[model samples]
Target chain A: MDQFTLNLLFVGASFALYIGIAVWARAGSTAEFYAAGRGVHPVTNGMATAADWMSAASFISMAGLIAFTGFDNSSFLMGWTGGYVLLALLLAPYLRKFGKFTVSEFIGDRFYSPTARLVAVICLLVASITYVIGQMQGVGIAFGRFLEVDAFWGLLIGACVVFAYAVFGGMKGVTYTQVAQYCVLITAYTIPAIFISLQLTGTPIPALGLFSEYTPGGEPSGVYLLTKLDQIVTDLGFASYTEAHRDNLNMVLFTLSLMIGTAGLPHVIMRFFTVPRVSDARWSAGWTLVFIALLYLTAPAVGAMARLNISEMMWPNGTEGAAVSVETIETDPRYNWMLTWQKTGLLDWEDKNGDGLIQYYNDGSEALAARAAENGWEGNELTNFNRDILVLANPEIANLPGWVIGLVAAGGLAAALSTAAGLLLAISSAVSHDLVKGAIAPGISEKGELLAARISMAAAIVVAVILGLNPPGFAAQTVALAFGLAAASIFPALMMGIFSKRVNNVGAVSGMMAGLLFTLIYIFLHKGWFFIPGTNSFADTVDGSLLGIQSTAIGAIGALLNFAVAFGVSSMTAETPQEIKDLVESVRTPRGAGAAAADH
Target chain B: MDQANQTPAVDKEGRTYWKANIRLIAWSLAIWALVSFGFGILLRPLLKGIEIGGTDLGFWFAQQGSILVFLALIFFYAWRMNKLDRFYGVDEE
Candidate 1:
């Protein structure tokens, strides 16, 4: 079968499985819809959380980012995984013990104020809405490439699929479907890595393969994989592959932002609420990391191998050999992936200086540009190599079986759809459960609330689609901004609520506003006001950033500002109510946690 | 709504349990910081002599080692905290 047909078959099969699970596990009541009746197994919830956590960014864009940037981007790996430690130890068990359906419920009840809940809902919506935009764009990209349709139509179809499952299944449907997604995505991710790893280093394990010697073409190069990669890239005038290229301070703050943000995200935090016990919440966090690590550990290996492969393909004999002829790139079946990706406008080449060869190098480097000038090359010819295409195109680049390529297409869609559904659920629940039911219409029936949830979900999808058409950044970077927003606002409030008895309603509410607004303004100033492009006063240059920290890494500072504001305001305000203080005490201990009041 | 659920003995025990939990968290987080930020990023040059595979140990720590340690730390904390929960009579039946 043709590659497109195989892609349709695998993608169709995966969607059928998701819809089947949604139908079988249709949520019966608000309890099931919101929290899956608090009966999910720790391991099962862990798998679902992994699916919920690893969005389009993790599955599609992360390895690609790692491939090109090398060691400077290790922050993405460590930051994302290390957050589970914070979640398990500091957040998950306490929140699960508090026994509420949504994250805002805990903030609302703990602070004993509807306004605090409303503030949290706003933060949740902002973070989730931003996050879902990346997922929608990911879905569009995956569908556009595989199905040969416009990205907008692909997004509409993806939104409809998500609406069908998320509206009907709610958290319950999303939970099980996420489990299936985790399986498909993990398999799809690792199989190709294993194939590439074996092909590159003769090692079956990608992580160990990263450390193994380079033995391509059955010739013992006697150089380690990373060592050879560094040599090759630097020789070609690129930065050393394994050296730190970013400022140390910025890397620290960026890692901290991603870590805290990961812990603070409402969709990830909400998953812990579904498990049966506080202990399970802790266990599930660990399990989620194990599943996430399965992809993460292999990602660097995949990246390095693919970079080597691309470098090798460009320089057929070696880096010193003649560049691959443009004629070959245009007509060679070995370079077929380039042609397919070129149609998506994400991959393109131009023979600058009218040279009949494609020279892919860092034209930005003066030294490389000089070398290109000496070689009669005008500039870099690999004009638009989108980082998001690395993993999806890896199997094709290595000439793997058609089925492997199809599997990757399905996996990318599963990753995007699973996360989009989870974020949509978080947004809908915040609107229905926290905003409407908790404040606006406390007397609303469960059925009415369910209807409201579905409507809000559909509305959230539409908003995400509109924003996705003009995504502010790459999938992972855009997702990282969501983490920053979450870190700056919601996470600190939730943590302080659990850990402190002194923080009052006024403190939490003002703190969230201060953090949310500060981070939003900072991001808008740099990324453009409301991310509309060309509206920013200052360019995203070193001078434009505060203390040389990019807007994406500013969340840790914003979170610190939040804590300072909360403590300062709380010291002057009245103490928490006695009942609320008791509630704080109740959440810390594990007994009677399983019997959390359904709150319906 | 359930003010009657509160007892002086439970409150006293809860305070102790919470203090112990805080101590545990403090220690665990300190290690978490040490591995990821300290070894992985800040103190990486200091550990240049220690090499794993082709890369230095610190680079591996940044990318892979720290994640494994995080998993271990969380599981260890969970197991220890569960034991502490049972000891304090705070574990769910």
Candidate 2:
């Protein structure tokens, strides 16, 4: 079969498997719907959590970002993974011990205030909805590319199928499907990396291969892979691949924000609630990292190798040789992948100087200016090579088998769909369980709540799909907003609710509001108020950023402000109730957490 | 019912367990910060001489070492805390 047909077969088979499992594990009760009946094994839940956590950005965009930016972007890897430490150490076990259905419920009961729960629900909704829209857009793009359909039609079909599984099978179905997705995505990701690694370094493991000798023509070279990569990139007038170029303070703050945001994301935290015991929650966080690390460790290798491959392809005779002629690009079988991607308008090239050769270099570099003038080159000729296409086009670029290509297509879809389902589940429970059952209809029956949960789940998917179709210009900026809000608002409130008894309702409410607003206004000031074009008071650049902290890195400062405001407000206010103190003491232990209980 | 009769004693044990847990957390977080933020960023230049794979040890920690350590610390905390819980007669039935 051809590549398109093979892609269809792989994606179709994976969908069939997921839908079948969803039907088999259809949720029967409110407990199963929300927490998978709290019977999930720690390891199994960890695999599912890994799938839920690694979204389209992790699978598709992250490797490319790392490849282009080099050491400066290691923040993405470290920040995203280190949050599990915070989750496992500070939050997961206690939340599991609290025996609550929703994160908002824990806040409400812990603070003994309905307003606290409402605020948490609002934060969860904003962060999760922004996050889910990104996932939905990812699903549409993946489907449109692999299936050769209009993106709108692809999104509609993908959304409906996800809704069937998520609304019907609930958390139980999503968990098992996500486990399967983890297997698919990991396998698809690693097979290509292993092949490329062996080809590039004569090593089977990509992570080890990254640190091993570069093997050109399958023979070991004395130079290390990273060392060779650094030479080639720097020779092209780009920064060294192995050296840090980002500002130290901003890099640290950005990594910290992502760490806290990863811990704070409602979809990820809800995964811990599915495990059977408090200790299992702790172990589950570790397992989640192990699974996530499998891809993360391999990603840098994939990135560096892809960069090397692109450079070699462009400079077939070496970087010092004459550029590859436009004739060779038109007729060469090796350039077929670029042609295929060009049809999608994501990859393009132009010989601006009419020199009949395409030169790929850092045209802006002063060091390259003399070389360009000597060669009569006008500017860099290979234009519009979008970084997002790197991971998806990697197997093709490396001349891997067509089956590997098909599997990657399926893997990208799985990553997007699984994360979308997880986010929709988070939104659904927040609305039906926290908003409606907790406040609007406290006397709701179990069956009625179950019905409400399914309805809200369907509604969430609809909203995500609609927003995804007409995604605003700021769809990308909103992701930073989501992380900032979660890092600033939700994480601090949750931590204080468990760790401090003195933080009364007034204190927690004010802290969340302060953190949320401060982060929002800072981001808006830089990225345009509410992301409207040309309305920003300051440019979204290092020079224009407040106190030299970028909007993306401001979440850490926002979190610090949250801790400060909460402590300050609490000290000045009335003391926490004695009952609330006892509640904190109770949640700290793991003795009585047999079943997840509804607060009502 | 039996636990209700031993309230004061259980309360004392709970406080000790919490204090022990906090100590463990403090130690783990210190290592966590040291690896990702300290060695990987601020102190990276100081360790430039200790090279691995043609790059400094700091780059290795930034990419791989810190993640491995995070995994180890979590498992260690879980095992140690479970033991602590059982020792304190707080393990779930």
Candidate 3:
């Protein structure tokens, strides 16, 4: 069969499986829709959480970010996975024990303020909607590349599929569907990694293969791969792979932001509620991380190995020796991946100075200019190579099979769709549970709540799909913003609710508002309020950073501000009602396991 | 609400039970902070050269390796905490 047909078959089979699960596990009651009736197996919930957590960013963009930036870009991998540690230890079990339907509900009730809940909902909606646009873009890109269509059309098609599956399924359908999605995406991700790792380092495990010796055609078995990579990168005027030039302070903050963001995200936290007990919540989080680690561990290796392969292909004769001829770039059958990627308009090059040879360099470096003048190069010509293309192109660069490439297309879509479905569920539940029942109509019927949840879900998908069509920013780039909002607003508040008994309603509300508001303003001052580039007051630079903390790191500061404000304000106020305090104690106790307290 | 049906409570020392819970949280949070924010971020500079796999110790902690430890920590917490809860007479039916 043709490659396109095979891709369709693979992707179609996965979609069929998802729809089948949706049908089989369709949620009937509000309990099932919101919390899966608190009966999910730890292993099953773990698989679902993996799918919810991976998203388009982890599956499609993370490896690509590492592939291009080398060691300096390790922030993406570290930031994404390390957050699970925070989730597993600090957040998951407590929240599961608290036994709420949504993150906002926890905030609202714990702090005793509807405004706090509403604000949490707003943050959740904004972060989720903004984040979903990235997944939509992933779905479109994967579909566009595999199906050979415009990404916007692919996005539209993806939106329709999500609307049909996600609007009705809620958590019950989604939990089961995500199990299937986890399998598809993980299979798609590992197959190509194993193939390339075996080819490069003779190890099936990509993480270990990354550290082992290079297999550069005739090189010895123990040849250090990174040393070889560093030598080649320096020779080509690129920064050394292992050396980090970015501010250590800023890198630390960025990683912290991603960590908090990962832990605080509503879609991810909601998964714990599906499991049976507080203990299961604990076990399930570990399982989720185990599954996520499968990809996070491999991403850095893929990036390093792909970078080595691409650079070698461009040079043909080693980087220190000779450059590839212009004729070779255009005419050589070996450089075909460049042409294939170019069709996506994500990779571009122009032959400058009337020379057919395209020279790629860091024109930003002052030292490289003198070196370039001797080489008769005016500027770097390999422009417009979008960083997100790195992972998708890795398979082609490694000269993998057509079926593997087809599987990657399907895998990327599964990752994007699974996350989008989870987010939609969260948004719908928050609207139905927190906003509608908690504030708008306190006496909402179960049937009414379910109807409203579906409507909100359908609407959320529409908004996400529309934004996906004309993504206001780079695909993976907006994830930092989502994480920032999460870190700034959600993580600190949840932690405080569990750990600190002193924080009251006015305190928690004000703190959350302050954290989210300040983080948003700082991000806006740098990334532009709605992410329109020129409208921002400050640039995304170390100089422009607040106290030299990068935008990614600023969320940590917001979180600190939240904690401080909540404590400062609460200490001035009277104690919380005795019942609420008792409720907090009860959640922690796990006493009389099945107590259905109206207050709790 | 069925008030009569809900009060089939266990008679236990609530003070010692909660204190035990507190002790567990304190210990777990300490290690939790250590592995993630500690080893992955703050303490990363201290262990710069000690290598694991192909990358330095810090990078391993930040990405692949720290998560493994976290998995171990959580499951251990689950097992031990459950035992502790049962001992303190807080476990459910």
Could you give the candidate ranking by lDDT, starting with the highest? Answer: 1, 2, 3
DockQ of each: 0.67, 0.56, 0.42
Candidate 1 docks at the CAPRI level of medium
For model 1, residues A245-360, the per-residue Cα lDDT tens digits are 88888899889999999999987887787688888888889999999999999888888899999988888868877888889988999999988888777788998877798888
- Tens-digit lDDT string for candidate 3 (A1-600): 876788788888877787777666773443455455367778878877888788788888877777666755667776777688678767887787776656887888888788888989988987887787787777777766766665667678878776665754553345777788889888888888888888877788988888888875545656578777877777778788765566667777777788888899987887775577777777888888888888888887888888888788767766554556677867776677677667656678887765666676677777677878887887887777776667766787788887887888888888877777767777887788778987899998999998999899888877777656555455776777778888988898898887777888888888888899989888878866566657777767899755666665688888889889989999998888876766666666665434222332
In model 3, pairs of residues that clash are A67-A303, A253-A553
lDDT of 2 by residue, A1-600 (tens): 888989889988887887776666664443465556268788888998898888877887678878888898888888888999999999999998877667787788887899999999988887787677667766766776676665677678778867765655453344777788889999999999999999999999999999999998798789999999999998888899999999999899999998998889887887787588888998999999999999999998999999999988888889999888889988998887887777655578999999899999999999989999999989888897766668888999999999999999989988877777777777877888788887899899989888888888887788788777655322223454577779998999999998888899889999988888898788778867545567778876678777789888898999999989999999999999987887787778788776776544
Which 10 consecutive positions of candidate 1 chain A have the poorest summed lDDT? A28-37
Q: Candidate 2: misplaced stretches above 4 Å?
A: A27-31, A149-174, A440-481, B1-10
Q: Judged by lDDT, which candidate is best?
A: 1
Chain A TM-scores, per candidate, are: 0.96, 0.93, 0.92
- Candidate 3, superposed: residue stretches over 4 Å from native: A25-37, A150-153, A168-174, A325-333, A441-474, A595-600, B1-12, B35-55
Docking class of 2: medium
Instruction: Mark the regions of model 1 whose C-alpha exceeds 4 Å error after superposition.
Output: A26-34, A150-153, A168-174, A441-455, B1-12
- Model 2 sits at an interface RMSD, in angstroms, of 3.2
Q: What is the Cα-based lDDT of residue A220 in candidate 3?
A: 69
- TM-score for each prediction? 0.96, 0.93, 0.91
Q: Cα-based RMSD of the predictions, in order?
A: 2.1, 2.9, 3.3
